[model samples]
Target: MPVIKDTFGYLQDDRRVDRITLSHPRSGFSVEILEYGARIRAINFPHARRGPVNTVLSYASLREYELDTAALGAIIGRCANRTVARAHPEFQLSCNDGPNHLHGGLIGFGRSLWRAVACVDGGSPGVLLELQSPDGDEGYRGNVSVQMEVRLDSPLSFRTVVTATTDRATPLNLTLHPYFNLTGDPDVSIDDHELRLAAATYLPVSQDQIPTGEIRAVDGTPLDFRQRTPIGARIHETDGGYDHYCPLLPGSAVAAELSSRRSGIRLSVSTNQRGIQFYSGNSLAGATPRMFRARVGLCLEPHGFPNALNEPTFPSIMVQPGETYRHDTRYLFAMTQD
Candidate 1:
């Protein structure tokens, strides 16, 4: 177990941006992260066939990330997804996503500076990143102290735990937005990637991407990822690719399983959260250096329902003053024998 610190780059005015690399030699697993946005710069997992693969989509330099608008490999906070207008009348959030506020508005946690510290525990090699949001920061109520701990457990496992404490009762949701392409090649499309989600129902969204009140079944629609299906099989059936929130049922708690046949890599996602949002990089154009193109990667975000604050029926994301918001998610990776 080794925790290595390096000067990644400077954000502005000689502001030293630091990065930490945690490696588990025995497992051949490593993760490099930057303090600027508490973003995961790269994830190296040893696949039986591929040797080592960077599972998440990211840029080679900090400059590209500073200019990145796609929210690549970053920690999203305040609220994870789009928040409806007047969702909470007291808040005036930045309307970056049409009339809705997207990913915590303008200065979201995904684009903020976080304090970093090295941690080498008996369990895993990791880093602890912390950030403080002011009372009225990003039009959210209450001052919040947020901490995200990223750990690499073994050969091909990454775990994250996000905790937040607010001074007052407020709606809060946090998620890691990581675009994953198991091919170990960014130039390839994920069209052939097969996926199965442990979901029987999904929340539909409006034209503006705000979640509708209706929770629809996946049995009849193309949203049915209940069975193993190639992503390209029904991608054309949907209007804007896969961008809906699928709520996990009692027996469907594993969340999702994605595999790329060409790479012989399989990813099983497990999380305690009730919902997972699957996005097929439909809106990406030139977001990254080489690996950024439509259908190149997919994001399986495990968290609470989007727009839950507006829809009372959806699981509440309220973090009380005395309570700490906690979320844990793990991605288990393996390579199938050919």
Candidate 2:
């Protein structure tokens, strides 16, 4: 199917926003993307009874999207996750999350407008969104240019390839923040959803949610999803819910798998990143539009270790001059008999 473009709405600054639709005819699977944040507005998957159900949490209008704090289906950049505040003396990173950096500061890349162009890859429909971040824009060094190529690779499957280059040495980690409910019904929670991770160990965090520099095994812990298990089976044992990073075991192409028996929808995530952040939508209780509830959706973000800038033991996220940073991830949706 051809990509359809339409007006989404206008920003408070009077800037016009656009939405792009990429559809696959054979599977009746489609994706809608808003140019405002390069966000995935919706992922309509074919259902036996419902026809096409939006399996991802999204806002009703552009206004609600502008007021979004949950990240929704947006692309996070500059650095995907958290970083310790005041750790880097030379780089005065903006502290948006209570003296700590969260999701690339207050107005991160997810909140910025990106230039979109229609494109096709190997006969697959897609779009290319580009953004330029000047040095010191987010208290980071170097002017970085990023390009995200989103393509519908096959029936019920899509892929994203993000590439960036910096003029000076700077920390760069980018990831997509999409909340999935599988059931496609806002009134439903993902408590019964089955999940599995390709991780044998995970990073333990302190009270501030920063990694404590220890790579611990998931065995004997609720974080263990080495085998498929219910999401809420042991959620109560944690402080709130799962919000830790699990390092992906080497040679594992599939990072995570999620499925909902209620909807018979299954989602598999594959990425080249080293870890995945499993956020069970702990803070979705206060989200806007009144349709949100805690645990109604979950986020599986694949990126580098958080606070890598502060932890010498963690792998570095720095990209030197003339070096191009690249990260690729794929999402496949299918129906399950069970």
Candidate 3:
């Protein structure tokens, strides 16, 4: 574990964007992290290829558009998924009463500056970033403290552990927003990739992309991913293409698998959350290539139910003062031939 500054002068916003590099001698793997949003900038696996790199889309070079605001590879928290306004049916609190509160009312953890805490001991092979948000910072209750730890187990795997504590009782849901390009080709769409999710049903959304408080079966719908299927196969039938929440089976383990046939790269996602939101990156619009399209990339966000606070039937998102909120999600990368 080494804490180094930007040697090539590539880092902008020096005060907020400190870099943390982790290397495993035996595994031959290296990972680079930025403290701005506690974002994972790069992951290099030597066994897969000499310079094979996995990144959450490069927002670093986009001057007109701020990288932090995009929530590229940041720790999203306080509340991870959507909330139907700020009104909690049980709690009787209407915070942002209109339609829904998506990702902590817009300017969530992605936009805030996190405090970097580094540990270089050989025993602790990773760095932890922490942030504290006062009550009502984003129009929500409870003063919350968030900690995100990035650890490199080997060249092929990186684990992110996010834990939080709140002084006041409030709904808490957290997840990582990482844009992955297994092929490393920005122009390439994830349509050809094969995906399989262990979900029986998914929450349907309305025109505004808000959950309708119904858990519909995915057996005959476009949301089905029980078996391997090409991502683009049924995307055109969907409004903006798959942006629904898939309910995970009870317990903690690997929930889904995404594989790119062309590159023989496989990504396995494991988490403790009860649901996973599969977003196909339908909102991405690139100005450079002059190619405006949907489903450019895919996101498998493991989290609690969307709008759980307002939906009485959904799982509980409330975190009491003394209870510590702990959740873990891991992305394991491997090379295979199909």
Model 2 bad stretches (over 4 Å): 121-123, 289-291
- Between candidates 1 and 3, the lDDT winner: 1
TM-score of each: 0.95, 0.97, 0.88
Which candidate leads the pack in TM-score?
Answer: 2
Error of 1 at 139 (Å): 0.4
Question: How would the candidate models be sorted by TM-score, starting from the highest?
Answer: 2, 1, 3
- Identify the runs in model 1 with alpha carbons over 4 angstroms from their true place: 121-123, 251-253, 286-291
Candidate numbers sorted by lDDT from highest down: 2, 1, 3
**Which TM-score value belongs to model 2?**
0.97
Better of 1 and 2 by TM-score: 2
lDDT of 2 by residue, 24-101 (tens): 867778999998879998999989898999999988799898888888999998998889867887788999989898
| CA-lDDT, candidates in order | 0.84, 0.90, 0.72
Scored by lDDT, model 1 comes in at 0.84
Question: Mind giving the per-residue lDDT tens digits that candidate 3 earns over 1-338?
Answer: 33444422223455435567777656656677766566666666554453655534554442322433445666676777666663654443323325566677655776566766765535236778899888877766788998888876655676888889988988888887776767766678889988989898999887777788899999888788888888888888888678889998666367998988777778888998898999887776642132324555667888899878777788898899999998887778888666
- Which has the better TM-score: candidate 1, or candidate 3? 1
